[model samples]
Target: MPDEMALLVAEVFEAAGVLRRSGEAIAAADGQTQARWQLLSVVSEEPLTVARAARRLGIARQGVQRVANDLVREDLAVFRPNPDHRGSPLLALTPHGRRVLDKITRRATEVHRTLAADIPVDEIIRARALLHRLVERVNRHEGDGRIPPG
Candidate 1:
């Protein structure tokens, strides 16, 4: 049997693959607008400064700025002056953005329901809880400037 650490690593990789595949499937179903979808998805939840959004998305600030600009042009997102930051702006989803997110959420719910139907509901809930715990642990460790030992 694989060592505990090795097993954990493998599970992590597998989970990441599943997430990537699910994202691709969602994108395919919605059409070819990954940036727009991502932007809409984030802004729908809460307003985020461009820099913070870029950091959360793991993309460069310039790239996020471009995407935000496009979203503004399309009337999907609006840039509001950031009272906290001198020159930076916070991005908020427009009404159109909310509508798009509603549609996407419905489709995502359907996909998740179909995918989870074969698994026991309890198992799914447990898995989600575990994943959330893992994420929280990692974030806490990273925030303290410590790399989690492999």
Candidate 2:
């Protein structure tokens, strides 16, 4: 039998792969792109500094800056003066960005419904709770300088 930790690690990897693949499949259908989706998603919530969005997305500041520049050029997002930071600006989604995200959301919902038809609602709820607990535990352990065991 597989060890408990090994099974957990396998499940984690599988879950991550599923999410990535699902996102890719959805993006492919409409010729949508990941960077654009992520940029718009972040800006959809609230205006954020490029550096802040980079940190939130776990990407390099330079990469975020490049994406932000492209978004500005495409008129999908705009940079407004940041009162909180000296020279850095806040990124906001344009109406075009909002429409793109809305379409993506509807498509993603359809994808989810199709893929999740076989999954029990209670099982999904339980899995969500377990994943939240796992994240919390790992974060706590990492914060205290301990390596979280798989």
Candidate 3:
């Protein structure tokens, strides 16, 4: 039999793919892609520099910059002057962007509700806990896993 840990990792990747596709469809209704929607969501709370947003999203700064530029072009978001740093401005969503994000969020909530209809809340909680533990352990390893497992 395949190692359980390996199988769990595989399952996580599969789940991510499904979730990404579902998110893409939800975002598409508002003329947005998954990447754009994610960036918008991140900045919806407060403005952050492209570098900060990229770090938060665990994605490349250049990629976030591209998405931020596109959002600005679409009038969904704006780049405002940053008092903290003159060179790197913070990315903030426009009024239109807030409406778009709200719409997408509502749609996503509905879809998630339907998807979780059959699953017990406790089971879902347990699964989330397990995933969280796995994520913490993975982060502790950083990029290299050469350390001997204790």
Candidate 4:
């Protein structure tokens, strides 16, 4: 069981790398990378502070902050004052950002349809369920300090 779990973990890492590269390709035409696209997508519905976005994305706050800064520089996003936290402002997409994101999303929808054309929906749902279960089990270890630091 342990060996099986280890193999699954390794496969997950490999899959993530492939997916990241694919995402970059998907967003490249829009002059955006996977990281920027993901960051924008997360905060599209509502503005979020850097920390909140980081938590939502399961990544470090500093990385998200850098991406946010880049987005702001490109005029794709803006920092608005947050009443909840004066120190950490909420990040929102500008009008230009929204337009770009919408275009990207439309393209992505078509790409996803093509990618899933050969795959059965039930299999995809099962795979997602398994990954979610894995995530839950791994997260439980964090509470008990079972995960070792790099």
Which candidate should be chosen as best, given TM-score against the real structure? 3
lDDT of 1 by residue, 1-150 (tens): 759867886988998788777876776675526666787787777899988998888778898898899888888899998888969889999998787777877888888889788999999889889878987888888888796533
- TM-score of each candidate? 0.79, 0.86, 0.93, 0.91
Which predicted model would earn the best lDDT? 3
Write model 4 residue lDDT over 111-139, tens digit each, in one string: 88998999999999999999999888778
lDDT of each: 0.81, 0.84, 0.94, 0.92
Q: Kindly give the number of clashing pairs for every candidate.
A: 0, 0, 0, 0
Q: Give the TM-score of candidate 3.
A: 0.93
- Give the C-alpha lDDT of model 2: 0.84
- Residue 78 of model 1: what lDDT? 95
Q: Rank the candidates by TM-score, best first.
A: 3, 4, 2, 1
- When summed lDDT is taken over every stretch of 10 residues in candidate 2, the lowest stretch is 27-36
Model 1 lDDT, full chain set: 0.81
Displacement of residue 77 (Cα, Å) in model 4 is 0.8
- For 13-115, candidate 2 gives per-residue lDDT tens digits of 9988888778877766656677767878887999999999988887888988988898888888999999888698999999987887788878998989998
After superposing candidate 3 on the true structure, give the runs of residues whose Cα lies further than 4 Å from its correct spot.
Answer: 143-150
Model 2 alpha-carbon miss at residue 103, Å: 0.5
List runs of model 2 lying over 4 Å from the truth.
Answer: 148-150
